[model samples]
Target: MLYHTSPNYLSSQITDNDQLLFQKKKTNDLKEKKDAAKQKLAKVTFACREEMLKLREQKAQVQLEKLTKRKDKIERLIKLEHEIRELNAKTFMRIKPMHNPTTTTLYQNIVNIFYYMMVAIVILGFTYGMTKIAISTFDSLQNNQLTIIAAETNLFKLKEGVSDIFETKKVTTSYSFES
Candidate 1:
């Protein structure tokens, strides 16, 4: 009876020890799983933050580019406007001559008269040159006709002389025959 009681007590003590060890092992495994999960979550959060920062930087860069483009456009427009203003000022100066209307008109009229006079002179010179050419051509043609007439007259005189000599020879032959 004493041995049986001792064995029962030893068995109960062993069971209690096993249960405690099992509970401790389970707690340790759970803690390890929680730590791993926290690490994974931390990595995911860090990646998300980096991505957000990159996106923000890209957005800022795009905005800066847009602003620069707008600034350039505005500057070009301003330059063009300034150039236009300068051109207008120059145009105003050019038109200032019209402030004295009578003088401007008189000058313009003088220039127009000169231009017309030059044109008339050119036309008169052309007419004179053509007339000279025509007169010279007429004179040359008249001279050629005179030369041809003179040649014809000389040829006629030669033929008459030859006929007269032949007649004289016939007369002489007749006298000789009579003798």
Candidate 2:
């Protein structure tokens, strides 16, 4: 349908429409600026978060390295402590000399005495064994000499018996018969 309208009304409506378009353009521009601000804020927040994560990772790595070093030191300390304990538990004769003169003298004397006692015991045992061997040898020699004497006496007696038997046979025999 077509309707007749006044020029004043048309002109007023067109001006109003132009004002509305300007307002819309201004609002769109404001919205674009806000969007850009939001995007910038998000980027900044992401960057900050990434930096924090990196810092945290670095801190963790440093902490781990520190703990590892501490653990290594503790292990070395434990080994050294064990070695010290071992050294402390060892006898003086097994290692370096004692520091104190009196103690060193005492240790020396004790060691010397023990050594001499062991040597004396060994020598005495060896001498006793040798003496026992000599005595046994002499006893064996005496026994052999007695056995030889006994054997010689038995041989002489056997000869005498044989001679007596021959003499008896000779006396008992008569003259032989001629054939």
Candidate 3:
């Protein structure tokens, strides 16, 4: 066909060849439309894929954030556990020396230290388990799966354990919850 270029965006009128080409183009418009539709579909598919990749990346970021928080919490809990253990040992050693306190003081300190150690150990275990569950739930949330919904029950169990441990000590201390 005839070919031409414009200095600006304007164009020349039709020649015989241009007319023939225009006729041919009209005849082939249906095929062009089909080609256009196929191109549109390809573009849409690519767009969908890009969106999927973005979502996956977002999920990965969320997972990374949760992992970072869990790492921090784990480090703190480990430090606290270590400190409690050391304190328990120190308190035990100090209480065992009767020359240190002959009155009921040594006995009370020993009992308190033992119970405190037990509480710390139990709490540490629960903390680790809960952290693991929280990480797992993050995974499940990203994957759109079921997650643990037993936090209340677990808290109740911990409370019961605390009560049971102190039952024999006749400790009737009332605990208050803050909103």
Tens digits of lDDT, candidate 3, 65-166: 999999999999999999998997666645644334443465677776687799899999999999999999888885653223466567789999988989
* Model 2 Cα shift for residue 145 (angstroms): 70
> lDDT tens string, model 1, 96-137?
242344334445555656777998999999999999999999
Model 2, position 9: C-alpha lDDT score: 74
- State residue 140's C-alpha deviation in candidate 3, in Å: 85
lDDT of every predicted structure (CA atoms): 0.83, 0.86, 0.79
Q: Which parts of model 1 have CA positions greater than 4 angstroms off?
A: 1-5, 98-179
What is the alpha-carbon lDDT of model 2 when measured against the actual structure?
Answer: 0.86
Clashing pairs in 1: none
What TM-score fits each model? 0.49, 0.47, 0.39
Best by TM-score: 1
Point out the higher-scoring one by lDDT: 2 or 3. 2
Query: Least accurate stretch of 10 residues (summed lDDT) in model 3?
Result: 1-10
lDDT of 1: 0.83
Candidate 2 weakest lDDT stretch, 10 residues: 94-103
